[model samples]
Target chain A: SQTIHQWPATLVQPVGSPLSLECTVEGTSNPNLYWYRQAAGRGLQLLFYSVGIGQISSEVPQNLSASRPQDRQFILSSKKLLLSDSGFYLCAWSRGNTNTEAFFGQGTRLTVV
Target chain B: AQTVTQSQPEMSVQEAETVTLSCTYDTSESDYYLFWYKQPPSRQMILVIRQEAYKQQNATENRFSVNFQKAAKSFSLKISDSQLGDAAMYFCALGETSGSRLTFGEGTQLTVNP
Candidate 1:
């Protein structure tokens, strides 16, 4: 069975600080990874998705960026965080095939103060 | 671009009763997929059911089932004998045939009353 691990489970960051969230998947190779953010009382918003290493696609333009450094490792980073950047971030992985469903991690809750 | 809609912001059902959550989607592509995801208080997104565009039969998983109307572009979920554990935020999602990304609706919060 495949599992996705995301950390830190929760974080409190001051405004204008940098941000880094990591997601790693075990037991799967060459999986499609995605980054999503959900604001309080809002729906999930797609931030970025990577089909392979070094390939990232941005769905919405914002301060956050995503990178796939390794086949099973994906990182979401920001040089400087904004107050609006605070939300619950989720990492998901899916088999490259079309019929496979996406599996989600526990998610990281970031509070920017 | 494909879009998903869940008009019901919230719904309530009595325990052991049946409740249906409505979902509608707009897509130009004839071949696509529709999914219902459950987000409990724990905030983990779990796949409840999925329907393929080409399939006419609805998808069912234990107590959960989907009503897939390809021509009407409507996909609804029916929970039979609802349980307290069924209370959660349900989201309707649409995924295109060519992309891995899924477009989700605003979600409907379902509460099971005793």
Candidate 2:
């Protein structure tokens, strides 16, 4: 069975501060990793997705960036945060095949003050 | 381009009753999959039910089932004997077999009344 782990379930960060949210999947290899953000009372928006290590695709332009350092390790980062950046961030992984059913992790609630 | 539409922004149902959530999708591909994911307050997406485009029979899982209309481009989720735990955000998604990418709808907030 594969499991996804996301850190800092909740965060209160000041404006202009840096942000780092990590997500890792165990028991899966070469999986497709994805980053999604959901605003208050809104659906999850696809932010970034990576098919392989060192490859990332941005769906919407914003202050954040995603990186896949290892095969199963994905990180969402921002150098300087904006107030609008506050939202629920989600990490998901798929088997990277034709029939893709993504499994999600417990999202990170980020509040920028 | 594939698009999913969950027109009802919110819906409510009484406990022990039936509730049907509507979903419509547009896709050019013939082979595909549709799914219903439940997101509770915890924010993790739980797969409620899934339907394959080619299947004529609806998919069911205990209290949950799907009415998959391939010709109509519709896949609706029906929850029977609803419970309080069923209150959550329901997202309808379409998966294209060629790309394996899922396109999600805006979601419907289902409130189960006790």
Candidate 3:
């Protein structure tokens, strides 16, 4: 059974927040990890994806960045946050090969005050 | 770049009735995959159904089914016997055969009326 873990289900940070959101997968090795953001009542936007350790491909360039420290661990970070940065963040993983079925975590709802 | 479009921003269906959500995509790749995801108010997204471009047969999961038109670049989801639990934001996504990155549409919100 594969499971994904994301911390701080809900978070509140100031306008200039240095953010660090962690996502880790269990029961799987060398899986593809991704970070996505969804606004209020809006669709999801892919932020970043990692195929392997230290290999991150950014989809959207913004005030955020992603890094893959371990095979199944992905982290989303920001040096500072803007009001527009407040949204629902999701972490997902899939088999790296041609298997495209994705498994998503519960998600993190961040509010910038 | 590949893109997906959902014409209806929102829709409503009576319980026990059927509803169809339209989704069209633009892609030059002949090998790809289509998917439908459901997101409740809780905001957790779950895969509803998937269709492979190579397969002509429609995919179904209980009350959920898809009409995949390869030539027209269209993939629509049909939900039968709609239930309260079926009320959620539905998203149409496309994944290229060579890569696993998914391109998602804006989404269509479905409301189940009792």
Each candidate's lDDT (Cα)? 0.92, 0.92, 0.93
Model 3, span B37-102: residue lDDT tens: 999988888999999899999999999999998989999999999999999999999988776688
- Where model 2 places Cα greater than 4 Å from the true spot, the runs are none
Query: What are the RMSDs of all candidates, in order?
Result: 0.8, 1.2, 0.9
Off by over 4 Å in 1: none
- DockQ numbers for every candidate? 0.65, 0.64, 0.70
Error of 1 at A89 (Å): 0.5
Candidate 2 TM-score to native: 0.96
- Could you give the CAPRI-style class of model 1? medium
Provide the TM-score for each candidate, comma-separated: 0.98, 0.96, 0.98
Clashing pairs in 2: none
Model 3 over residues A1-113: C-alpha lDDT tens digits?
Answer: 99999987999999997999999999989898999999878888999998899999999889999999899999999999999999999999988887577889999999999
Ranking of all predicted structures according to TM-score, beginning with the best and ending with the worst: 1, 3, 2
Give the worst 10-residue stretch by lDDT in candidate 2 chain A: A93-102
**Per-residue lDDT over A1-113 for candidate 2, one digit per residue giving the tens place of the 0 to 100 score:** 89999987999999999999999999989998989898877777889988899989898899999999999999999999999999999999988865668899999999999
Worst 10 residues of 3 chain A by lDDT: A94-103
What DockQ does candidate 2 have relative to the true complex? Answer: 0.64
